[model samples]
Target: MQQPEPLIPLAVPPDWQDAGSAILGGDGVRRVLVLGAPDAGKSSFCRLVLQQASRRGRPASLLDVDLGQKQLGPPACVTLGLADAAGGVPGLCALSFQGSLEPLAAWPRLIPGTARLAAAAPPGLLLVNTSGLLKGAGRRLKAAKIAALRPDLLVAIGADAALEAVLADHPHIPVRRLARPAQAVRKGGNRRRRLRAEAFAAYFAPAPAWPIDLAGLRMEQAGVTPWPAPRQLVALLDGAGHDLALALVEAPDEPHRLRLRAPRVESPVAGLRWGGLWLDPGWNAHEIPRPPRA
Candidate 1:
């Protein structure tokens, strides 16, 4: 593959510049996992690494495991993108739907989904960019991801005791610690929510409502009860279990069928799994409360 063309130059910290160069300078580092708290410049650092690799004519890929603020594809999905630096975010190559915006709520799907997508990345320097969830259980999730991916290098981007704790779990892997660059702007909670809302709106903007018959396809709600109300998010899965598209529930016109506002599904939908949120037509997301313990 032709090396990805360079985008606008990024002004990162001097140490970050050296780290990016060193990574591509060929010390036998292939798979790299970048971790840090929110707004710590993990994504920016990955972009820098990609640009450096591109300049050197090295093929590189990015596995975006951040469901909320993704570098490619929509929120709530782990996407693999071949590094094409011409665009701000790499082009979408593959994805796995975790169905939750928060990494904590999605760990069951997050770790394995990341591993699966990382496995599918095209051969080259695979840079895995993860969600900035580094407190409490989030710390364990980060460590679990490292254990699963077993990346050649772990790039922790900020100073957090939690980050050190995670690094301690895997002593064998080489690590590069860098301060969060000044360019990294800390987004407030409300700002983050607005960003997610905008992303959802952009993703579904051109989609038309599609009606699906449940007669032949498998329907999986599993532990979810009372059936999902209108506007619930759902994932239509292919036979091999990859997501075909995400749809919002609409009132069914017929029994044993579902109407959804989603992009056209070109391939057959073998099954669908219910998500734990409701997304209104206006793109606002509301969590679906879990059923009371039996």
Candidate 2:
């Protein structure tokens, strides 16, 4: 028997012309949500739509809600940016999530984060690139976002029926389904983890180690674990849960303070959450799921 084709490829499908037409067709302002399973060409499709829209000189904004597969910002963040943002990376601003790569673990944050980031966009068309968590809780999470955002068009890029539940729940909203891209490369678990480490390193590259005085720090939310007394990774967040800095916390010399090895930061720290990850001096990461659940 002949071998079957792989699920995803590194190139977009040849029939993408229809996808573009259906997406950009007859629109004053197209509010779109491009969603699908992991490596199902969600990001590729988003870039394609943006390119086509730009050629027509139509302005557009982006709400990157995929914490794991993110091009708009570092992993564990939801970034809001413009199509033609002047600066590099186009990261206008970011919302801190649960510091997780998988969508289910971070769904609680993704729901509110999507709305908050979308709200930051100017009044015009928007394209939301979502995490590829399209079954079970993932479907429910994505569906909830559609309900809250009420986008005009939904572009689902794969043949999977995972999005059907969302579409049925939202019968009123229009949906367009496109085949998975011909060249969407699917990376294995190790590759994904390595990519995350690279992103983490890059995000913290600009600034050096900084410290925080826990005695004066006020937190609106925190992890359940007992505060670390030794070196451990943590995410510094604002009241809105946007990560301001990533650091390695060292035992404090003073009762009210903790030391951090991180980059320069501007946002005031409203809270600190212990990272389920441990980053050595080399910045390599390993996961620790059940860190502090108290």
**Across residues 144-217, which tens digit of lDDT does each residue of candidate 1 receive?**
89888988999998889988888888899999999877666788989777777777777677678878888777
lDDT of 1: 0.79
Query: Residue 289, candidate 2: how far off, in angstroms?
Result: 4.6
The residue ranges of model 1 lying beyond 4 angstroms of the native Cα positions read 1-10, 85-87, 222-228
Q: Write the per-residue lDDT of candidate 2 for residues 76-131, one digit (tens) a residue.
A: 66777777632123434545555556667767776776787787787666888888
Which window of ten consecutive residues has the lowest lDDT sum in model 1? 1-10
Error of 2 at 227 (Å): 1.5
Error of 2 at 116 (Å): 1.3
Question: Candidate 2 — which residues are off by over 4 angstroms?
Answer: 1-30, 85-89, 228-233, 239-255, 261-267, 289-294
